[model samples]
Target: MNRRNFLLSTAALALSGCTTASLLKKSTEDTIDYQREKVSGFFASVDGKKLVVLGADYHYVMDQIGDLPQVLQSPLKPRLNAEFSYFDLDHDNHVSGQVTLQLKGKVSDAERQKLQMEGFECKGFQEEVWTKVYKVRGTRYLAKGFELPASVSKFNHDYEIIVRESHSPGVKRAMVLLTPVTLAMDGVLVLGGIVLAPVALIVLSNTHWR
Candidate 1:
């Protein structure tokens, strides 16, 4: 190989190395940001008679419960939290589960009924749940597509979060799944940039230029 060809290959490898360095830095920053967000956020839950919460353990004991986020609002006081439950409202149990309701535009009676038949319940715009939804001009209704669970005299416990890990369950699971792939990517970057690229340059210069 000529000097020109060797120089071109070296330039290409250097560019590749720079790109991979940027990728590695970005990947690391993203992972750290995600970690910070997960740890900073809070979770609220009601086990049975008391509100079983990580941060807010001082709320009044209640004989009967009110709406979840409402009951939690004052006590939680400035910190944001999402309520989690083990009761399968939709009867579809997922490892990562939540009942998500979103507002739709101008839902007529017929449309409301159709959504209802499809296991969605429509709430009027006046409801607290629909407050954000009502901001949109045409969005008149909020739909939650799930069959409400049987009224519990006492809450049933179907799941538990062991306090061994600081990371959220979802994040922990994701990291476990992504670890191998992340390691493989790092290995490739290190090999191509640090080891293989230099070795290739030296070998080519010694043999081809002679």
Candidate 2:
């Protein structure tokens, strides 16, 4: 090949490789953004009886991410050492229970008024299960109780407790709309990884690139 032509061909190949690499990097970043926004947090039940939740744990299926951030603080922090109980309310094979919540934090008078204006009344009582959602001193607390029907209790059926919150002063509200259901831990792990994988990859890639 002539010197001029050879140099031109080599330059073209380099340009092509650079374009491909740029496109790949862009694609990866886009995937990461989608996964980040798709993070939907949930509380999963473990052992079909009690819920072991690190509140605000997010999961995604595309990138395998989990436990993004609890973000429980800032006017509403999670109450540590929370406990729940279940009891049989009726003798007719039905169960019921009550939930009590204790929270510690600070709330402004305006926010307190806003919370009341928002009509944040907690309601989730059935069989022997009860859930009380409330805010006190800028801390949010969800106390849940579960009781199984006599027939179901025999087999120790699993249960999940979902909590929802709302505020009038434009605070981000948290809610659990789906009916409590059983989910495999393996599925949860996989979904969590999908959500967090992009962030992890970006961090690692940037480190290596630098």
Candidate 3:
């Protein structure tokens, strides 16, 4: 191989090996702290079948609805309608891990008790109203009062059972597991290319030298 090609191939092989090792290590790590993913969306159902509908242009989180079909088919369905307003505590414009989930609907005493057991508080009869003000060009505008239920639980976003009503645990795990494998495979291909490139170059050099 030419000196340049040999060096490049060696670098590629080293990089690929490093990448694969890192991915495998990350996959096995048990101490990874996944920050909360903030999302604004509707967690609703049709005829008792539930689904999570995220706001347009927002990213869908695997931890949120990765295994949607399974959750829909599971026996643990909540009778209460869920309104989730996820606020970005870090203002990163990405995933918001802090969430204000408000549940509203008629519930049986048993259901209420179940929710209570799960750390939901019963704040009887609540409503929320807020006015949004903005300016466009030289004109100022007021987006008049919008309303929401005052009953809310501010919690660090984890895959809660209530949120699980529209999520699948299996899918999230699969997605996470597949990513590193795919990357490793790509790295292997690059390493293979690195090996082949040098051999081809070496053959070409020998033929020309002869």
Candidate maximizing lDDT: 3
| lDDT score of residue 172 within candidate 2 | 37
TM-score of each: 0.21, 0.24, 0.25
Worst 10 residues of 2 by lDDT: 197-206
**What is candidate 3's lDDT per residue for 108-150, written digit by digit as tens?**
6665565555445656555321111111111011112311122
lDDT of 1 by residue, 39-72 (tens): 1112222232212111111111112332432323
By TM-score rank, best first, the candidates go 3, 2, 1
Please estimate how well model 1 matches the true structure, expressed as its whole-model Cα lDDT: 0.26
Task: Give the runs in model 2 whose Cα sits over 4 Å from its true position.
Answer: 34-210
Where does candidate 1 have its weakest 10-residue lDDT segment?
132-141
lDDT (C-alpha, whole model) for all candidates? 0.26, 0.28, 0.30
User: Whose lDDT is higher: candidate 2's or candidate 3's?
Assistant: 3
